[model samples]
Target: MDVAASPTSGPATPAGPDSAWMLREAEQFIELFYGEGNGQGGPAARMAEIRAEVAGTGTYTHTVDELAFGARVAWRNSNRCIGRLYWRSLWVRDRRDISDAAGIGTESVKHLVEAGGGGRIRPTITVFAPDRPDAPGPHIHNEQLIRYAGYPQPDGTVLGDPRNVGVTELALRRGWRGAGTRFDVLPLVIETARDGIELFELPPEAVLEVELSHPRYPWFAGLGLRWHAVPVISAMNLEIGGIRYPAAPFNGWYMGTEIGARNLGDTDRYDLLPVVAAKMALDTSSNATLWRDRALVELNVAVLHSFDRAGVKITDHHTESNRFITHLEREEEAGRTCPTDWSWIVPPVSGSATLVFHRYYDDADLRPNYLRRECPVEGGPDRT
Candidate 1:
C-alpha cells in the first residue's frame, strides 16, 4: 500500500529555456549521440524528427538506447566522480512512464534491492518521468534515499545525523515520525502538484546496512556506528538533450573516505574523532600530537575493514585513485578530454598521497549532466 494518495497530475514544468534554446541543446546532444555511433538512425534524420516534435509539442522523447547511452556518458562526463572507470557498467532503470508517487516509491525500493545486489553493489540509476512543457516531473525530497533522520534536541544538539536535520524536520511536518533512534532511516518524501507531498517508508529488505567495526580493536563495534550499503542520490536533476528528469536517483559503491573521513569524522556531522581518540587513549592536548589525524586514520581503517568483512563491495581511496588515473589515460587514448575537478577527485583523508591530488584537469561545464535541482519544499535546506 502507498503511504499517501498518488497525485493524478504533476506540477507545471518549472520555467526554463524557450523553444529555441531547447532545439539548440537538442541538436547538439543528438549530434553527439549520433557522432558517437550510438544512434540507430542518421543524425540529420533524427534532428529533423526532433525539430518537428519540438515545433508541435515543445519536446521530443529519447529512444531507450539513446537514454541509456546518454546516462552512461553523463557519468563519463561527471567531473567529481572517482569511480567513472566503470561508468559504462552503470545499470539504467528507465521508468519514464511512472509519474505517480506510489509507483516511484515502489520503483525506488526495487532500485535499492537490485542495486545493493546483496553486498555486491552495482553502480545504478533509476530515471523517472521528465519535466515537460505541460507538466513537471515528481521530486524526491531526501538527498539520498537512505539518510538517517536528525532530531533536533532542546540542548542544541542533533540526536541523529546533523546533516539531515532539515529533511528530518520536513518529515515531521508531514506527520511522519521516525523510531527516534540515531540510525532511523528517514521516510522517502515524494512531491507533485496534484498530491502536494507524500511520504513513503522504505522497507527493511530494501535498506541493506553495514555495521562498523575494527579488525584490530573490538571496541569499535561498541560505538554503534553503521551506514547504509547503497547511497542512492535522489535529489539531482538529470538533463539530456534539453529534457529534464528531475527525479532521477543514482548510486555508486561507497569509497572508504566518504564514510570515515567525511561523514563520520567531520566536525559538523557525526564528529566521531574525539570519541575514537578517547577509545584509543590518545592525548587530545595539542595540535602537534596529531591525535585527530591518528584517530581519522583508524576510523578510515575501520570503515574499509568493516565493509570488506561484511562481504560488501567497497573501494579504498588509494585503489580508486589509481583507477581514476587509468580512466583518465583511457579517455585520452580515445581522443577525449577527461574533465575532472581535482579537489573532488582527490580523496579527503590522504590528499597528498593519492595520485589524483597532483594533477590538474579540464573542468568544463558539459551538457547532458546531473544538475542540482531547485528545492520544492520552502525553507528546507538543500541536503546535496
Candidate 2:
C-alpha cells in the first residue's frame, strides 16, 4: 500500500466507456506527475506519451522528481484556477554529480508565482551544499539554512528587502526549543549523474541531520506527526554482503507510512518526534474518539536481527512488508485492549530484536509537562 509507486504496470489502457473513464483519470494523474501536457487530451494520452518516451530512451527523468509531490506541491501553484495560496523553497547546492542520486526529489515540491494585488508569500526552505574547503570535490560536506520570505514572483524574483520579509539571519535557527534550530528543511536531496539523479555521500565522520515537517502540520504537538512512529517499530538491522547497515532513522517531519487513514488534525510539538531519532511512543489517554478510533496506526518499534557487522550501502532501496494480527492487550490495564505484539528476527549479521518504547510528549504550553499516560492495570513511565 505504499502510496508512491511507478504507475507503469498491466493494462492501464483506456478502452471502453468505463475503461476510458479510468484511463482519463489515470492520465490526469500522469499529467500532474510530469508537469507537462497542460493542454488537454485528458490524462490518458499524456501518460501514453510519457510511457513511450521512457520506452524509447530507457530513461524516465523529471525536473520535479516524483508525480505526487509535483501534483500536490508544484502544480497547484501553476494551476491558479484552484484559487489557493502557494509557497515553495528553491534550494541550491555548491556542487552535484549525477551518478549518486538515490532518494532525491519528492511528492511535496511546487512552483509558485503571484502578481498584482498587495500579495504576501513566504518561501521557506532549507538550502544545503558542500562546505567549501579550499577546493570542493564531492566531499558531501555542506551547509544548510532555513529560509523564509514574505513576498516574491515566479521566475525566482523577489520584492523589497528580502531581509524585511522577516527571515531570521542566522543560517541555523532553532524552533520553540529549536524553532530556530539551524538545519536544512528540504524533503529529499538529489544530485545529477551521467544523465539522472543519484544519492550523495557524506565525507567520512561528517554527519548531518535535520527535522522537516509538512507545512500543514507545523507545530508538531498533535497526532498528525505521531504517525511517523512506525519507522521506530519497523527499524531492523540489515546485513548484506557481510556488511552491517544500521537502520537509518525515519528522517521526515510528517508520518512516513503508506497504510491506514490520513491524519488530518493540526500537529502539535508532541507529534513531531519521529523525524529526529528513530523511535517515539504516544499516549492514547483512553480517548476513544482520538487514538482509539482510527482504523489503523503505524508503530515504530526497534527490531533486533543478525546481519554482517559492517553496514550496507543504501542505494535507491525502499524495503516494505506487512503483517496482520488480531488480539492485543494494554499491559498496564488488566482489562483494557493491548497493543499488538509482533517481532522480526535478525539475520546472521545481527541477533535478537529488542522492543524499545520511546514516548512522545507535549512541551509547548507547559504549566506542567504532559507525561505518557499509563494503562489501567499498570503505572506509567517506569513500569516493569
Candidate 3:
C-alpha cells in the first residue's frame, strides 16, 4: 500500500495558530471562493466579518458553502492524485458538530457505506470538527478507514498486510482482537481530547470486499485473494484556510494498478508475484525470462477483471492517465495551475506506457491541501 502511514503515537494535539496568520489565510480563501463565482456575497464583506470574528475569538468559522468549496478545492490542489477531473462532483458530508470518539467512529462507518454506494463507489469526504483555538480536533489512528490486520508470527513472518503491523499492535494493546484471518479488518482507533482513545469495529456490511479471480485462470480463485472496494484515507489532516480538520476521512475509487502493481505485488507488501509466476509456470531460472513482469501484468489483469465482473467501480491506469491529461487541459483553459507531482502522477506499473510518464510537472506545495499528520513522538513510528 503506497498510502500515507497510519499515526502510531497518541492523539494529535496540534497547537493553536496565530490570529494574524489565520485572518490572512481566511482572506486568501475567501477571495478564491468569490473569484471562482461560488461565494454567496462579496469577498470584502466576508473578509470584514472574518476579521471581526478572529479579533474576538482568535478564529473564524466557515459557512457550509465555504466548507464544501474549500474541500473540493483541496482535492483539486492535491498534486499526487490522478483523479482530479471530477473534483467538483465530490460529496461533502458536513459533520463538524460531532467531535466525540463514538460519534466519529459511527460516522466513519457511515462514510464507508455511503461512499461505497454498494459497489458503485462515489468520491466523498466526511469533514469532522476542525481544531479550534482552545481545543484540537479528533484524530483517527489508522491510515485508512478500512485496512487488513497484520499478525507477526514467532517465525519472523507476517500473516496479513505488513503495512498495518504498527496499528495492529496498537489495537491489540487496546484490548481489541481480530478473527485471526489474513484479511480481517482492523478496528478504528479514534482519539479525541474529551473522550480519550476508543476502539470501534467496523460492521461487516459496511465493508464491501471483492474476491479476486482472473478472467481466464480458473486456478486464480484457489489462491483466495481479495481486497476492499473503497480506499478511505483517514490519517491526513485537511487544512482549509488555516483550519485543520485532523479526522476528515475522504475516498476516491481505486485504480487497478494501485492494488495489483503496488499493494499485492510489491516485495515489502504481499509480494505475490512469485506465487503468481509459479502458478503460470514461467521460466524463473534467469532474469532474462522476465517472469516478474509477466506475472505483474497478469495480476493487474485479474484485478481489473474481478472488479469489473463484480460491478465495482474501478479504472485502469491507461484510462486514468488519459483522463488526467484531459484534466490538465481543462485546468489550463480555466487559467489555473494544476500542480502535479510527476513521481506520483505516473502509474506504478508500465510507467513509460502511460501518458503521464512523459511529462514534467510542478511539484509545488499548495495550500488548502491534505497534509501528512505528524507523529507525536521524537523519532516517529517504529517500522521494525
Candidate 4:
C-alpha cells in the first residue's frame, strides 16, 4: 500500500476494522460508482451521517445503493483478480437475511442456476449473513459451492483434488459419500456455532459440468475429466462498512489455466501432468525433456476446446490479460489507483505472453474486500 496516498496512512496495514478507514473507503467507492449527491447531497452528507453514527453508540446501515456499489468496488479493488474488466457488471444478490442452513442451501442452488445462466456464466456474488457486534454470521465451509471430492489411498496418490482432501474426508464422515470420480460436488456445508451445521447435497441438475475433450483427440473424453460450469466461491468473508459478511461468496469467469495448470496440473492436486505426458507419449526422464510443459499445453487446449463446445463462458489467458490492461487504463482515467498483485495478474500459463507481466502496480490492499477466515464447522475445520 502507498502510505502517502491513503486516507488511513498512519497504519502500515489496512486490514484492521477502523471506522475512519471504513468511511473513507465507502466514500471513495460511492463517489466512483454513483456520482455525488445521487440527489442526496453527495457522499459528503452520507459520510457525515456515518461518521456521527460510528462515533456514537449506534451502528450505521448502508443503503441498498451503498451496498450494491460496495460489492462492485470490492471486485475492482481485488488485487489478485484479473477479471476486473467486468467488475462493474457483477450481479450482486443481497441474501444477508437468510441465516438458516436449509434456506441458504436453497438459495445456493438458485445461485448456481442463475450464475451459471445455462453455461453463459455470469460474474456474480451472493452475500449471505453478515457478522454483527454481538454475534457472528452464517458461513459456507467449502471453498466453492461446486468442487470435487478427494479420496486418498494408501498408495500415496489422490483420486481428485488433493487440496480438498480434508473437506472430502469431512463430507464422507458426515455421510455425504461420493462416487470416487474426478468431478464430484462436495456437499455444501453451511453452519455457525450458534445455528449448527447442515449438509446440502447439490442436485445434479443444478450443477452444469462440461466434459473435457481435446478437439484433435477424441480419447480425451474417455479420460473422464470434467469441471463445473460455475465457480461460486462461498468460503471467503466479505468485509464492507466495517461489517464482515462471513459467508459472502463471489465468483468471476475462469481462465483455462486455473483448471489446466493449477487444479489439474499441480502435483499436490490432481497431478495429471504425468498421466497427460504419458498419454501424449512425451519423455519425462528429465526436466530438460519439457514433457510437463508439452502435456500441459494440450490439457489447456482440451479445457478451452471443451468449454467452447459446451457453450460455457471461459476466458483464455491472453484475452483476460488484455482485458486487465483495459481495466487498468479505465481506472487510471477515473483517478483511481488500481491495486494489483503482479504475480496474480500474470497468467499461470505463459506468464511472459501477457502485457500485464510487463508492468508494476500499486499493491495496496483496499476495503470492502474478501478474506479467508478460520472457523470450525460443527464436525470439522473450515479448511476452505
1 or 3: which has the higher lDDT?
A: 3
Please write out the lDDT profile of model 1 over residues 1-384, one tens digit for every residue. 000000111122247768888888788888889888886768899988888998999888999988998888877877777888887887999999999999999999999999999999988889999888888889998878888888889999889889888878888998998899889999999997668689999999999999999999999999999988887888777788888888888888888888888779988789899999999999999989999999999999998899899999888889988998999999999998787877677778888998988878887767677766556543232212
The Cα RMSD of model 3 versus the native structure comes to 3.6
Residue by residue across 258-288, what tens digits does model 3's lDDT show?
8998879988778899999999999999989
lDDT of each: 0.82, 0.21, 0.83, 0.74
Q: Which residues of candidate 3, in runs, are more than 4 Å off? A: 1-14, 376-384
* Residues forming the 10-long window of minimal summed lDDT in candidate 4: 1-10
- On lDDT, the stronger of 1 and 4 is 1
Off by over 4 Å in 1: 1-14, 376-384
Cα-lDDT of candidate 4? 0.74
> What tens digits encode model 2's per-residue C-alpha lDDT throughout 7-115?
1111211212233343344344455444533444554655666566444643223223332233223212211111111212312111122123232221112111110
What value does the lDDT take at residue 219 in candidate 3?
99
Q: Write the per-residue lDDT of candidate 4 for residues 214-302, one digit (tens) a residue.
A: 99877788888988767777766676656677777776667888888877888877888998888888889999999989999999999
TM-score of each: 0.94, 0.21, 0.94, 0.88
Q: Please give the range of 10 consecutive residues that has the lowest summed lDDT in model 1.
A: 1-10
